[model samples]
Target chain A: MLGSEIPVFMTNRNTITEQYPKIYLYRRIVQAKLFIDANYADNIDLDNISDEAYFSKFHFIRLFKNIYGKTPHQYLIAVRIDRAMQLLKSDKPVSDTCYAVGFESLSSFSGLFKRIVGITPSIYLMQQQKIKAQIKSSPLTFVPGCFAEKNGWLKNRNFRETKS
Target chain B: MLTKMTHISINVLDQDSAFDFYTNKLGFKVVVDVPMGADGRWLTVSPPDQPGFEIILTPVIRSMYSKETSETLRELIVKGSFGVGIFTCKDIFATYEELKAKGVEFTKPPTKEFYGTEAIFKDDSGNWFSLAQLT
Candidate 1:
């Protein structure tokens, strides 16, 4: 017990341990985000998500918003809308894509999708189809301007040469 | 003569989550956890049963790094750009399952390789490591 009483370093403060609770709390919040990412297709709500993070609904909302810049409900909607956009781009029908992304009703899905993405799912799908068709007809137009220019394939094309 | 390496440093975005991940999920034991104040924490953990070698869970903070550097490092960590090291286990399948059950994220399942059976997993902050069972 020679060195035990002195406590080598002054001020018995293990600062890192003091911050462990905050760190573990952050891990739980991140865990909730990962849960949403993995189960966005399921019928997940604030209750399920908050429970997943082991936080109460109100506190979880505040913590999630502070970290992600959006409330839990908003984040879930954004995630659903983001996935819906990807599915719609792949030519999935709007109704199927809506249900697939966990929206119960087509109307609510379209409304939320338009509010977030600035276009209806059907319109977005049509736009994606149009772009795909254009790409198919003239793939060079879709290539990066610098890439085309570097390959000397832009000599006769009317591409408004984007500045590198 | 340097007979063995003592510590390896891992850059983490958040020391708190990194600590939880290393201690709770990975089951590493904390060897040293001292706060360096503005310079962040001097935190190190050793793998279970490996008491000598330590893995320093260094936090990337503004005091220790410039704003641009910290931002870049944070992005890189989240993008899983770094593969820190390899850890060996007695049985890769059992270890993988146990870690998986604890919510550890495995980027690749246990797969057969020419050298050994390996599985890749990422820590909470996005730094990945290879877990292998050498044959």
Candidate 2:
């Protein structure tokens, strides 16, 4: 009973049939964002992200930027910077945190970090340390070593110091 | 004291389109359509049979949310991750067929379940709803 071809109805500009493609485009854009969110820590590039959404890079980039008001690269950087902030908060060394957040080089990581967060990693670490020192009387609680290691945090202080 | 839900919100990708979808396809009645600010409207709609509760068709605009959050909400909506709620009809089969004729896309055709005869349909922005004739 459901196999028959339904006649296409077009009553107005807001018809669901007319809106389907636009809705599909929105879905593709969301898929692209989900892909970036899931793989932000990996070596993800624009081509692969667009591929994940089954759209051409140019089309995906345009739609993503139009819908989200930011380019895919900008979103990726935001995601990476957010991860880097968490790593830095946990006292991970600058260089380790850079690679852990998927930056190819220290210079690029530092440049973007300063551009976005308005400070270099070391300076940010210093600020975090100052905050921690102020709250030291409350007894610092470290996330368990297993969770730390799972998040790519170096558990050994000497290793972190040497890397820094 | 406010003890019951008088209004609920359903975030839509666009307010104008949502107005059409809810009013034209789903046969909801517009409750309010007043201007809110420079670019927003206080748009709300209610089901034909239910007038006391209004569903606010809020848009995911820049003024309402940050760019990241707006984008995230749009993503969630398009991914069909948000289920607005279940709507009850007198006859599930009749309602399902009537909605389908009105261009609503049903993800699941009417089926008999332990609870009732249930069907699923998606709105213009990909939010799904269960239209059921509960037992």
Candidate 3:
């Protein structure tokens, strides 16, 4: 009797499992995202990433977007742009930063950066430079020093009073 | 004239996971689970004792949002930027223990506030809700 019921139980379990297949798909999508995060700087592609997650490219794209709310390419671009923002904050040039962030062309990089970040790479660099300059030029209001007379605080106070 | 709300929507990161979180973990009942479009589902759930009201678990997908908007909303949701609303129970402590035992992640355990005894737990998509037993 138990042996006869085994296939029936398996069929019922499979039916229930089919009702919530997205949970398994969601795990595959997460694996794809982990791959993207680790290798965003490399020349990643749909075929390779999908293969890594053991999914077809078409199904992977739909499942990934459904689960993550962003397509794999969009997520990759977001990651690349984020890294580009950090690189651009330093002395890196826009052209070099573009390629360094995994974009093959400068124009496409600039276009995507503008669309997502609301500014072109050059403009972002200019803003970063302006921020850096402002921070550099701001006056220092406090300095650490000993307050004891031997450390010159009293002498400085006296000098200030005499000047005033 | 529109005095009572019968349905509300909560944007979630994933509909399937949200369904599991709401129904299994939070002890809500599935109200509806229908296909919305090719890539989306119209999923809703209700609290155990709340019969009429349903909370739709809407996925933040690109069909209803641009790429940038979807990205921004997903980021915010993952960062716990949206607090969906409040749910009330008769015994806050008991409900909290029950939900916690069911694997619900609570940001704030049950504590006595000025208004009531409240706890905070986030949905699967990172939107938080306050569970309170008011005085």
Candidate 4:
């Protein structure tokens, strides 16, 4: 039987594959990187980057996708999803984890989480707990800084550390 | 209040240059080129598929008054410190290559986004355009 309560939080994985140099897209990417860095959790708009880039809501979406290669909302949601993933491994509740990463709709959050991770949040939670326990029992050694991390380049990886 | 984006207008420094650049380099369909009132203005183009999306091939009024506004605007575009960006593309990579080959100057080369490959290029008069891979 499934556990009495579903644990929250999923794992995190950033650094979406980029196949080109940033010289041409530096400005727009920087703007997006800034927005994502600052408001990946809070609501952010194109204008938030620079007045020159902002338009109406839809325009902003189009502009962001055109410049950044991903819709702002999609990118931001993915950030939260990645953060939730790590939290899941650490014993956070799925629903609470969802909100902590900025998702307000539980149903939507669950659906998207499953889509990205290939299983329902509940199932993933159970599997992660099992893995965590197994790993704890297994004898392992590591160097001073093993650097077991994902998207560590973002530096904001700390986003999940202080998250409730 | 809500309708699919039918068109957009951009101010240019020279109508003739804008016309040739957009039509020849960008391949926008030229739907009309009628003259307006005395001091009569002329020149316009539309996307072949969406004839309604008209681009106003008019000179920036400031350029006509003095070069100061033109210089300021040019600097802003260079710094990416101007207005909203217009992204036009079907397959952003191919279009990016095509424009890049046409001697277009770009702020950056194409890069992959979760949305698609994207690039930024500027017109002769310093108007910025973000070309996205058409999806």
Please give the clash total of every predicted structure, in order: 1, 0, 0, 24
Query: Which of the two candidates, 2 or 4, achieves a greater DockQ against the reference?
Result: 2
TM-score each candidate.
0.47, 0.45, 0.44, 0.40
Candidate 4 residue-wise lDDT, B21-135, digit = tens: 8876776766544332221243567764467777656565421435687566556655666444655655454455456556788786765555555677787677777776644
Best by lDDT: 1
Residue B120 of model 1: what lDDT?
Answer: 88
Chain B TM-score for the candidates in order:
0.94, 0.94, 0.93, 0.75
Q: What CAPRI-style quality would you assign to candidate 4?
A: incorrect
Quality class of the docking in candidate 2, CAPRI style: incorrect
lDDT of 2 by residue, B24-94 (tens): 67868776554433325657789977998989787877354678988999999999999999999865544
Candidate 2: regions farther than 4 A off: A1-164
Please report the TM-score between candidate 3 and the true structure.
0.44
User: Compared with the true structure, what per-residue lDDT tens digits does model 3 show for residues A14-73?
Assistant: 212123434455456666776776789899877888887788888889877765568999
For candidate 2, write residues A1-164 as lDDT tens digits: 44345432222213233223355565567667667767898988788878888888888888887755679999999889977977887789999999998998999999999998899999998887765554342211222234225323333323322433
Worst 10 residues of 3 chain A by lDDT: A139-148
Residue A149 CA displacement from its true place in model 2, Å = 44
Q: Ranking by lDDT, best first?
A: 1, 2, 3, 4
Q: Give residue A85's error in model 1 in angstroms.
A: 0.5
